[model samples]
Target: MTKPPKTAQTAGGETHQSAEDLGVDALTTNHGVPISDNQNSLKSGTRGPTLLEDFVLREKIFHFDHERIPERIVHARGSGAHGVFEATDDISDLSKAAVFTKGEKTEVFVRFSTVAGGAGSVDTPRDVRGFAVKFYTREGNWDLVGNNIPVFFIQDALKFPDLVHAVKMEADRGYPQAGSAHDTFWDWASLMPETTHMLMWAMSDRTLPRSFRTMEGFGVHTFKLVNAAGKASFVKFHWKPRLGLQSTIWDEALKLQAADNDYHRRDLFEAIDTGDYPQWDLGIQVFDEAFANAQPYDVLDATKLIPEDDVPVRLIGTLTLNRNVDNFFAETEQVAFLPSNIPPGIDFSNDPLLQGRLFSYLDTQNSRLGTTNFHQIPINAPRCPFGNFQRDGKMQTKVPKGRANYEPNSLADHGEDGGPRESPAIGFSTVNAATGTDESGDKLRVRSESFSDHYSQARLFYRSQTEAEQAHIASSFVFELSKVGLLEQVPGRMVSNLLNVDEDLAKRVAAGLNIPLPMKAPAAKEPIDMEPSDALSIHKNMKATLEGRAVGVLITDGTDADELAAIVEKVRKAKGKAVIVAPKVGGAKLSDGTQQKADGQLAGTPSQIFDAVGIILSEDGCAAMLKEGAAVEFVMNAFGHLKAIGANDAAQPLLDKAGVVPDDGVTGLDSKFVKAAAQRFYAREPSVRTLA
Candidate 1:
């Protein structure tokens, strides 16, 4: 700067040519007016308040103030990605939807969300996840609005609002945001017998999915598939992850919330950006009316599920997410999904909850978007051509040239312009099975008797779990019930309901809470002791591979550089990521006198965020880390969580300080360590912490 150098250092600290020298375009306002000074507001003096005449400041503030729109009522916190859904198997025999034609690729936008959180909520909450996908098909936009869990909390749509209100934060306190471990929720749940089945799933590890890529999705309602000949078959939709199902323990999930608020979102974004595209198989469980009637429970019941043991899932298609959204608010936020957005070949069942959602979603879009023209938004618009008689609503972007706005008009014969008319042959047609009333014949507001047995599946779920998983489920119930401070009886009432599901489970939860076991609650229908289904257990179904997992490498000054590189290479060879954590953000100098950059700082990034951990320390580094609490916690938490731990000889002191006992999962740095790190040593859990 003393001699006015050729390149000047910008505010970002990088030397660059001036805008004029670089021939860059000048900044302009929305109206295309040149903006001379954007750094400072127009003012009477240097320290004066912004002048009213400053149009730039006024415009910017006005737009900023109105930038945010209303968030979704339930699935408020979400992450989305652009993807392609490819038909791998021909399902035209089951349905005539073109998207099911073998080898056909359809553009899709998928959003993964937490059900009971605000837009600013953390990602690792124990809650139901909304898995909604909008397929831009040739016929129209087909939205598959579903959830990670197969069943819901209620049997009928009428109880939906009450369920949501109870789960949400209390109106007076407005506290306990993004959680359902309060008195109001437990009190309401204890009174509603239909919630028993879903509560079991919600309290289990299913609600604590490790990542969206490892979670299973369900349509949550019985639907129908109509063929070209108008023959209908009842179906259930399932999205099975390519990586297999996986979840974090309750303790790990709690710690993850503190380590990274955007854990899921960041994982999705980074995965897509790095070309590690996530994939899922679209599976369908198809059955006829006879099979549906033959089941122990009603197919029309929203609270029930067709066990995989009963009806095998047929793999029909694959969905791969390969791109992150360019603008999150423009694409992910403004996108609207409705259960009513079905293609011609697909139709709905008479499920009471499904019926209510068909009306609720359309009405919600109207109120939230403040216009019926939300269809005009690019994200929500259909890919195929669309036209209608309706026009001139708020935010209308299309200009229609026509004298006739209504259908069944003769304006075309008089040479006046007429809009497009509905197609009779190729357009949408409602399935005959969905058009009539049920055998009851009366339009009464009542739940079907077939939907009454809720505890049988709950028992099936509990008995299906591994011993460790069952203990975790019991502990989770005790933890959540303990948070219900307002009602001491609410915990007992919940335990009483649990008695109908499994007496042992009820006893375990009661013992954990230090409360006396209550008498069994009366069930509308006695629970049948259904054989335990292995498909319902996460541990039984987990893939014994390290692919798509992550590991954290703890390093310090003078650590072996060759060992660090070898560990990272091994992880990459296994299709996993190895992140480096050091004491300082600038990282440390290795034994080879080479500086290596750290992916994260030790204090900020905890071991909970990774599937496994490795500690490579020098003798001096070990001494230094002994006095650091975070270093001790890094090893302690990983060992206590039953995660595989890899360490060098020098790291023994730090491991000893953290009370890490030698186990199968705790291995010295070697080829065997990589394979061991791929799995959680559940046998070591009992030695580390006592479970319910």
Candidate 2:
């Protein structure tokens, strides 16, 4: 009999048992070679670069990469655009990368996507949004790949496969696409306390973005910027939207899925097509080793974040997507982003998740694009000069001019000037000073002790939110957990984990599900109360402006032309889009006997997609609108969604029919409507919906 390996408890009190002890098949390579340590890759030391010889990782990731044919395993559903990154501030003190040179303009491609979904999934799902930018720098292509949320669910890269697998559609049923509110996700999350922080973000309004242009983007991992003096400063990248932060209500997000499958994609395309370029100010938080050492949590831990209050973000550049994709398949689909594609001055951190990503993304591109020559694709190719001696892989597109395939040869005499000889001064170099704790030591597969305080930031995020936002989070929890059927213990187990975040939050979720409160999950490190960051709250940081917003104008037959024109003018002047909605796709006859052309039809364009609504109906038009279900919903949904509604006196009957309550956001068709349309009425949420 094979003797079973021993089981030990982690600091979190979760018992990790061996395969034999768990009565499960041993995890092995594709060739059936036994994997002794599947949880961590082989490295020179615990906090060191992953060794190239880790076949377990290679096999697992290699297989995972090709799981879907011609589609990404994650971030498959994407919307991309051509852009230019303009360096607005001089950051020569920070890095030598020419992309950071003042007044320098770098062509860029930005891909925004949702994780845990297929290419066929709807755009408006409650999931982490990928924000990856490929900067065609003078040095090289710099791929600053990240997400909308600042923090990730797990610390180590080894757990990435598991985390993604759990959140993906369950294998047996292959259902619940593009969403985390399912049995497999909760069951896995209930056991892993590290997921708590990101779960908070995923459940929040952050996931339900109003537009791709409005959401914030984060690097999620600490990186290094090497100055001309070889001075290294740890940096976190941020993309602050020019339009400001905006999000939809949970109900509004769901309705948007039904209203338009490609809501975000279409919005992005139309905005760019109409010369409304989406812009984001590139910001960076620069810190030193001393400041990093002083933090309560490790900066290398991907699950944690350094609040903007602690280290304020410095705006350095602007990212503007001014052009839509010419071809979706050739440009958007084939564009590959590799974490390894860093410019000379930019370098990696010892972030475990980042380390794994550095290794996996290149392989992913190869698998998806079906060749080693993926860089030959115009979208992924760098605009800067590039050459190498090595050549001829599958689908080799470039032609090498000379016989200089190998390095360290006197091949210049053989009609070639030794193709792309190494230039140490001009090329990329690594800062070799000690950074991570125990940079080199024994080859042990271990989780960092510094990464154990999982619940502290989670608690901080919850406490930071406003009361209304808190209720949305709690309600989101209830809605997600209620989907965890058959796994009866999972909901309670997840609630226990939530108890560690906040007892009130746990109780609210428990009450929402009609379940008794469970004891708090054991802490790996006792969670300490951290200071609440106003920057973390979407509502607190939201900009109250109509710019980049879309206002739907509901007009019917015999609608007041003067009122319609006034409302449209106000919206345009405020830099907001005015989309005319009517009973028919064609023009609607107005009071002035002029035909009012509509941007969308009543049944097709639901109120959920718009920021605010305006109803300009005559008495007969109101009667006609009241009889139509779409018109009634157009008003009801706007009210239910907490959007500003401006209606003419004739539209009062339709408003009353839709159960519209009078609030600050509910105003007559006047100047107040434009002001009110600029923001959402959060106070009215409680009356409109039953939140946890």
Candidate 3:
């Protein structure tokens, strides 16, 4: 009989078994072969692309792909748009891809999605957003799949399955749709310290974007760019929004979820329909091996990021989403994007997380589309001519023309068209000279020593934010940890991990939870303090402009027509949108004896949906609105959310009744109102609410 494995206790007093205790009953493959190192995948060298012969990796990912049928396992709820990417700068020396040629335009499709949600989940959840772009270049297709945040939770692909399993709705009860504030997620996160850095981003306003157009996109892993000279350089991709970065506060976000379930999707479609096309600039941080080696952390680690201060991003192209899809199911639902689909000049790197993604995305498409010929779909097909002799599978749409299906056939000599052949001259080539990768190197599953530091960047990110932002982060942690009810150990375990990131953050959360702070969790490697970078804070980088903002104007019967017109004109002049809200959607009688139209009903269009709000009311009109519950809450919420509120003298009584204290954001319906509408009143936040 086999002896039972010995149990080990964690800092939180949780019992778990170690690999050394497994002895005879060890973890193994389906064939019963013991896995030597389950932490990392098989690589050719210390830092090299994953090897195909790594059957352990293929088996693990293959099973995960078919776990469900039809709907995607992750990023299930998504919104897509058709667009064009035009090269605005010359970077031919850095890359040979035609999509980057100056003055060149390529057709592109982009999809924005929420992670860890089902197809029917709400869009306003505090979750990571997927920003994936598919470019139909002359050289074929290139998919730049990324997220709104720069760093990830895990470093290696082998742990991806575990991370997803923990974060998803718990297996036993199946609750908490599209959210991570649960026991399973916190329990898993407490053990993995590498999730610290991304936790700061996840808890901040970055995940609660004002709209899809207001978020920044990032390629989370390091990639390689090859020039026409065959010289390769490391590169990272960034998509800077033209509208600038903006996010909804936690309270506003909750109210928005209750008001509208499809806020983001509707915003994207309306922006394109109204000819206010959303645009973003494509930027790249180019570097060489020398620069990568000098960094304190490994560039190949997915949990780490190279600060923009180290390598300033250079703008090269612009992408404008100009068209909405004709059919939602045909275009948006069926579109497939694979990270492995890269043009000639753009190539893969040895990043373990990225290497696993190349294989996982292809298999995912196969599972969701339920066919190998999914590329034949119109939305996924290439614009340029493409053909191959290999054919015949599930849902095969193309029919071969001749009997010369076999390659190296003499059919061309017999006056027959031999299908496409390999072209070494104009085809994509993988750099194989004295580069970093080598197929002949030793095969091992050990992780590199450089990939151990996990908390340094987390500290840098927390300290970079403004005081208000820091308070929000601490409050967010308290709210999320409080939801882990009855899992008493999980909350303290998480606070222990936070101690390594910031002592103040840990104390704030501990005090909020009403629990004693525990000692710091064990660290794999001691964290070092790095220079603060201003690029990390959304507050520090926000632009005080109304280029893509929306303002809500409240009007009543006998309201001043001149004041309403002035507000609309001023909002429009600033390139912002003005929406009129009234008691009835049909309209209200104005002072000019005209029945003015209202864009939305006051009860339906709460102040949470707009960036700023205006209140214009007559003496009798204010008395009537004071009796309505929705109207009172509307004004109160706007004030509590720190949004600008413009009111006429007659509306002062209503504001006083709703507890709207005088502040910089509250002004008379004059030039001061328009000027104040451009920014959020962060200074007023401390007075309106208490944070952890």
Candidate 4:
């Protein structure tokens, strides 16, 4: 009998067996040999070259050399967490998927990523966000891979490579990494009319999301849901944040890169770690084949969207991310998402982009993961018991018990164990409609005429935005196109494409770029002014509440403790966070002679990271801060970014120096300041900066 290891309590107050007490068997080399000393390699002297005969050193170095798997080609920079998906409404009539059964709670892992840039890139780039969720259900693993935007740049899958190549860093210069605001992207986008609709969204405030928790996600392609009776219906998936839509202004987004490179990633990690779990309601727009046929735009077109007003979204589930990953590399990096990983109740549509993705994801995973058994990786593995005749691939983890690795084996007759068999009754089946076509014809390389109406939805999106949002869109276009120095004609061509979307938008962009307006590009189909959907506008749909938002309070030595405490308490009561930003991390000494700690230092954490800002200072503190450039810029930037500001009487001189005028958003520290901090003052934009 082995002696039990001695138990000890960790710093986190959890009891665990002491590693040293576990004995020699606990620490071992790859070959099962016990390691005596792992801290140092075998060297001739204390600071000499390592000996080549040291097997432990050799093994450790060799393993470290191959430790990293290839990063994802698209969504390389990502963050993940563990969570549960709870089905709140019964959708058995639409799909027989166990994950969709009422009251069923399926364990899930979710990864959010930026579409462009390498693993080392900053999080605040203007790029599409990948929202991929892997659900470990009773049946099998199901991956819902989607984007924050509802539509895509191209309708056909073959054009995906070209689109990515254009948006990525230039091959020769390798410059403008992690952003599309460059020559190559605008040059390619101006030439491709199919990209106009998506370009509109890319340049909008949607690309500058304040945080991942506040962003909305959509399945870019239409999918099919199959019932137990073999009935299929067209479906589109959506994830709406409970906190509502919120986006940073263009200037604020730029400042955020300088403020904190991992702003979004840190925000998500801290939110979950603090037990303030982020949640999204899963909704689906389900319609029959008849509804698809009646739509003016083709259902298979990836650039088009079914308006929420046309087909109301039916809320079916809620996904809450309550736990953070224990290991970033093993879980966040190794996890793979396949669009084709559908369960028995789900099927595919003829959406060409989706069809191409189904094949692309699996192939990419194989090449990147360097194994056909990538699914065996714990993060990507199925939770349910799974057995198959497929055996012996690279990195195979399971060992089949018997010699009968093939189907229809008779090893059981000899009293030997037989492998598991398939169940056709519960197995996944493709929808019958997948083989049928509305207009049957031979396969061809040409695009369908129904997919050519590229400008209508672009126009619809632009016209639907509020005046302030439209101005932001126009300014973004100007900023991106202005960077196209290599192609002198690119801006004009892009402006021409914009003409089809909105004439005023094109004219504004042209004026901002100092270029003459060009004629509208020839549309394959004429544009139509579709009715504006209020849901398409962020400002119109945003919840004017401070819940889940952060407020930064700038303080210094001799600050008024009572005023600072009161504001912080009010923010907490509103379900908002109060971050103290002081001149030093050691924080300020209040008038009461007590030293306080700060959440951030003045120079590192800027006002851009917070929803609103409050300045609480004593006469001496205010005088000291007025001399510091960071303090002036903090208040000035907050006002310029259209954020609410709260100030104490002692901070009046600092506000004057920062050029802040009396506005509804700029309030004294009182009950009114709390209410004002809940929302932005968009009307104050003109006084701050010029718009396109």
Top TM-score prediction, candidate number: 4
Report the C-alpha lDDT of model 2 over 1-692, residue by residue, as the tens digit: 34335675779999877777777777667676657777788998879999889888888899887664588999999999999999999999889999999999999999999998999999999988999999999898999999999999999999989998999999899989889989999999889999999999998999999889999999999999988887788999999999889999899999999999999999999999999999999999999899988898999999999899999999999999999998898888889998889988888888889989998998888888888899998898889889877689897878777567888888777766777778888789987533444376788899889999989999999999999899999999999999998999999999999999999999999999999999888999999998899999999988889988899999988998888899999999999999999999896999989998899999999999999999989899889887899999999999999999999899999999999989999999888999999999999988888999
Query: Model 4 misses residue 214 by how many Å?
Result: 0.2
Off by over 4 Å in 2: 1-69, 413-416, 433-438
lDDT of 3 at 203: 98
Q: Where's the lowest-lDDT run of ten residues in candidate 4? A: 431-440
TM-score of 3: 0.89
> Candidate 2: which pairs clash?
none
C-alpha displacement of 503 in model 3, angstroms?
0.9
Worst 10 residues of 2 by lDDT: 432-441
Give the TM-score (vs. native) of candidate 2: 0.89
Q: On residues 499-524, what C-alpha lDDT tens digit does candidate 3 reach at each position?
A: 98999999999999999999999888
On TM-score, the stronger of 1 and 4 is 4
What digit string (tens of lDDT, one per residue) describes model 1 on residues 1-692? 11223466779999766445656665666666556679989998988877899999888889898798888889999999999999999878888888899999999999999999899999999999999999999999999999999999998888889999999998899968999999999999999988999999999999999999999999999999987777788899999999999999888988999999999999999899999999999999999888877778988988888889988999999999999999999899999999999987899888989989999999998887879999898999998988888989899999888677898888889988777888867777877554232454777867778888989999998899999889888988989999999688899999999999999999999999999999999889999988889989989988877788999999999999999999999888888899999999999999999998999999999999999999999999999999999999999999988899999999999999999999888998887788988888888888887788
Per-candidate TM-scores read 0.94, 0.89, 0.89, 0.95
Model 1 is weakest, by summed lDDT over 10 consecutive residues, at: 1-10
* lDDT (Cα, tens digit) per residue for candidate 4, span 95-144: 99999999999999999999879888999988889999999999999999
